[model samples]
Target: MASSALQVFGFTLGVLAWVGMIGTCASPEWRKNSHGQTLIDNTLKYEGLWVSCTAFVTGQTNCKDYAEFFVNLPQVLQICRALMISSIGTGFVAIIITVLGMKCVGLGSSNHIVKARIALLGGLLFGISGVLTGAAVSYYAQGVLQDYYNPSFAQGLTNVP
Candidate 1:
């Protein structure tokens, strides 16, 4: 009984994580620029993998999508985008595998050991998806920080929102 309960809980959490990954990939505000802005400026700049946006104090927002060509983007952005997309795909596959292997679903083999191994494989895929997400976010953040702190870099041009 306890094992069944644990499996349900794990499945719930895994599904939640997969949904969160999808949301993250679709969100357009991964990084924001609000430093040293006065009320007069009244503009907030933010960007994500696919779009850049500016929010005005007047409650207006304008966004622009990235270049159409994949090869035209910067190396860091290209890598981050690839990683996030891959993470989402992997998470989706993991969810399907996990559901099939779940005790309550029992879609295939009835043997406990086989089902357990399948579940384990799904869990590993989830782990890999998480790692990909982390790597992408961390790498992008590192680039943002480097640009933010660089003396030679133009502050006004950092966030293209």
Candidate 2:
């Protein structure tokens, strides 16, 4: 029972950590153009607000993939002990840190309509990626449960002596 409690707590904490990371990473400084509508808000480069969407798609690099970072840390830390949720915490912090970097580049002049359309497109992408990431994590956790926590997978069978 105690172990179960611990596991439950850890999993709950992990979920929170993941969401927090995404939120932090996704949010950018609310920078507004002369028109004052928030050209760069919450780390989103509103389309008509396309500061540099091309830079993103070139594929040579990606602006700190927040979701991937959040999703991969927990498993890696199992190899050691000091990490202790650092993976999760780091993910959240990383996005927060990088947003500042991206903003420093500054956006080019884009119309409000273009920015709104871009923001809408970005929202769609974010939704799809978020769902895919969540599903992947769920599948991973299920695998862990089945392989390690399931009694039938281990030596729970009783001896017929």
Candidate 3:
């Protein structure tokens, strides 16, 4: 079960890498236009999250560091979660921006932006679903990390009681 979970998380991490690369690979010329600019910005934003994730999974750094800085307070953790969630949103924005940019180029007539929109929307949906599922698996892995630093605390009520 745990292996399966880790696989899911790893898969998520891979998708994030792909998104980051796509965003990076997008043309700089696209940035000249406002619409294209938005897509590039959003894509890079998601890229940042994936970069962070890569660092964490590699044991170089982890979100827990940020979470700890906030003392894991709801207020601070909220910010952390927001960052993670926004990564998903950023991916969607990239897709939308890319599709819109494509449409602006006159990719097709009649169908026009419809197909572009649909393609981007579909990609976003798939990306988001992957991120959501990955988050669940990653959350479980957190226990192993917590145990390493403070075994007693993670063991159960003994840490608090």
Candidate 4:
């Protein structure tokens, strides 16, 4: 009925969100600004949680892991890395709880109220994880914006987006 359908829908959405969280955490384009655009000497660069990479149009790529220069990294990036990983853990917990609480599942069949409570708890956890993810992204984005608008950063830029 309606309850079962809604539960299925929520679970499906949760799965999608989990995938998206993983992508966001792993993406190297969280903050990027590239320069040059020719097949021979083009330079493409991007920064991620763990490393920063620069690629040449000749198919050469060089990456420097953050751990090597961890002390020099901005505070926001450090916080972002921690939050993203924690959010993934929270999302996993939510999915497990929701699946067990589903009506079609046999894990928690003692009482309807108990199952419902578990499902509600899962939903709440999803909300919490979402908030944490949002905060992390926003914090990093703000830093990027600040850097983009700063005079010192603009002084050496050539065609940035």
Residue 158 Cα positional deviation in candidate 1, in Å, after optimal superposition? 6.8
Runs in model 4 with CA error above 4 Å?
A: 35-41, 68-72, 156-161
**Number of clashes in every candidate structure?**
0, 7, 0, 0
What tens-digit string does per-residue lDDT give for candidate 2 at 88-139?
A: 4444443333222231223532454443343334334334444544543454
lDDT of each: 0.83, 0.35, 0.41, 0.82
lDDT of 4 by residue, 1-161 (tens): 23988998998998899889999999988876656566533677888887788887777899877764346667877789889998999999999998888877889766888889888888888888898899999988988888888887778653322
Model 2 weakest lDDT span, ten residues long: 46-55
Please give, for residues 58-83, the per-residue lDDT of candidate 3 as tens digits: 23533212224334343423443454
lDDT of 1 by residue, 86-119 (tens): 9999999998898777777859789888888888
Q: Please list the residue runs of candidate 2 whose C-alpha ends up more than 4 Å from where it truly belongs after superposition.
A: 1-106, 148-152, 156-161
Task: In model 2, state the lDDT of residue 15.
Answer: 47
Rank list by lDDT: 1, 4, 3, 2
* Poorest stretch of ten by lDDT in candidate 1: 152-161
Top candidate on TM-score is 1
Ranking by TM-score: 1, 4, 2, 3
lDDT at residue 120 of model 4 (Cα atoms)? 86
